[model samples]
Target: MRKEFDLQLDSFMLHCDAKHLSKKTLKSYDQTLRLFAKYLDVELGITDASKVKSSHIRLYIRYLRARGKYTVASSDKGLKVNYPDRREDYKKDISDTTIANYTRNIKVFFNFLKGEREIKENPMDTIEKIKPKRRQKQLLTPDELKLLFHSFDLTKFHEYRTWLQCRLILDSGIRAGECCGLKPEDIDFRSKSILVRDTKNGKERYVFFGHKMSTDLRRWLQYKDRFSDSPYIFPTVRGTQLEVNNFKLSVRNAGKSVGLEVFPHLLRNNFAKYYLIEGNGDFVTLSRLLGHSSVEVTQKAYLDFTDKEIGKKYQRHSPLNNLNI
Candidate 1:
């Protein structure tokens, strides 16, 4: 027999599916709801959403903070063999950001239940919002950037493709998934722009590239044609679309080779930082190019520039420096 909580979760997931939410979003909702349901069942012997209260949710939040990652298995199938060499530090407390995400997901689930009139009272109605502490953004120096780029062995086909993909993200500020979804037809050489179809918010937008990137892209296309006729601009050895995680791992390994920590998103972040600080670009245009829903979202992510970065930007835009006395 199915539990009442599982039944309600299934209904909510069906609603989400009807709305055409992304797979990643659906996965998040499923994971968060299932984990909460498990906690409610085991800890409080509560198997129904209608019986849940705000106090129970608060206890769950505290429990999450005290629990360690990978210590509890969602299933017993792989409990014995998973992560045999788990380090002591791997059992550390969960971060505020992760807990905040869980809180948000739980709130959304309760809201859905309330909207559907499935529950008498919303347990999350009185729960306070979780705000994660913002960490300072780190930018790569010029020499470090150069070292990272040179770490890729461009003679190999996969490495060459990765190198060009990294350069494209640095030049265009496109997300890793967006980069992976690119096709040859998406590139407009004449306009030096790419039509990005797959985006986080399900909106399509155009992102531009520099002359140097355009030249490199053209060379890459010609070289790629000599080997594989893949549908995607960046494809696997078997001519399949490259997965985002695989690309992230490739970038991470490349950075490790050069003794630096890096990822595809870091390249995108650097692109935004450079555009605003060094290129004298405006947030409005950058936000549009980066496919941000709003300029405010873009600012919230990149506005925390360091003091030296602010001074450098001011030096370039200083009125006294530009005007002759």
Candidate 2:
């Protein structure tokens, strides 16, 4: 008797949980697999994991490409309440990037099923990986940064904390989640570096800062000590670890106030861009600092510099220009 799709999915999720994957990753896998299971049951009446075929998977991909966002809900209850503004992009097509992600999640799930001996053959093995068009990463300008930073009300504790978080990301190229996970003990004043314990890859690494950031960090620490004794370096007023979403919202609103579009990740992106283009830094050092698995990953991300940025980099390294010929 072949195992039911939902039952095998539950077992796979359990295995993933035991491996200590990040909450975001776990949620993605769960959501994608559940949706795929639902599609299989409704479209093909196939509930057994072993009965799924490559043709069924290809049909599902076509279905995904043809579908619109928010067209399907896990349950029928409160559909109107959940999506109140149906007029607002109710029929917008799902992006290629999202479809690719769903396909990847499905492939991972099928691979797990095969590995666990739940299925003799992986249905997704024959399915080609969906390649989405790479979108250019937007770099924040210096003028925009100045405006966004100044928009924050430094007198307020929450705003001050968020301002410092933004500064840390821009100065050190640390992710927003890593910034939220910081503890006072992680900071090494002597070395001007931070020990990032909670990272995307689950590996600990050191990210450095400069003298200006050092001074600001000291002042922030002194002020924070006077008010709260939260274990995290940056904490909410209730003395709890600040959530990444809250920090993201704060940064977004700050940008809105200054009439510019900004997000926490953009700050980190600017850090990498400037580190290479302006600071004349190399890929290997930046890769290690950013805690990438390898130099290739870092290069793939930061190598999409615009023509103007390339020209600026070229001018600095122009051999004849520097040789005074």
RMSD, one per candidate, in order? 2.3, 3.0
Q: Global lDDT of each model?
A: 0.89, 0.89
| Tens-digit lDDT string for candidate 2 (110-223) | 889888887888888888888888777787888888988899889999999999999999999999999998999999999999999988877889999999999999999999
**What tens digits encode model 1's per-residue C-alpha lDDT throughout 3-120?**
9999999999999989877667888899888889989999999999989999999999999988877566555654665662264446688788988998888888988998898876
Q: Best-fitting candidate, measured by TM-score? A: 1
Error at 48, model 1, angstroms: 1.9
Instruction: Estimate the lDDT of model 1.
Output: 0.89
The residue-level lDDT of candidate 1 at 12 comes to 92
Candidate 2: where are CA atoms >4 Å away?
A: 1-3, 70-92
Q: TM-score of predicted model 1?
A: 0.92
Report the lDDT of model 1 for residue 96: 88
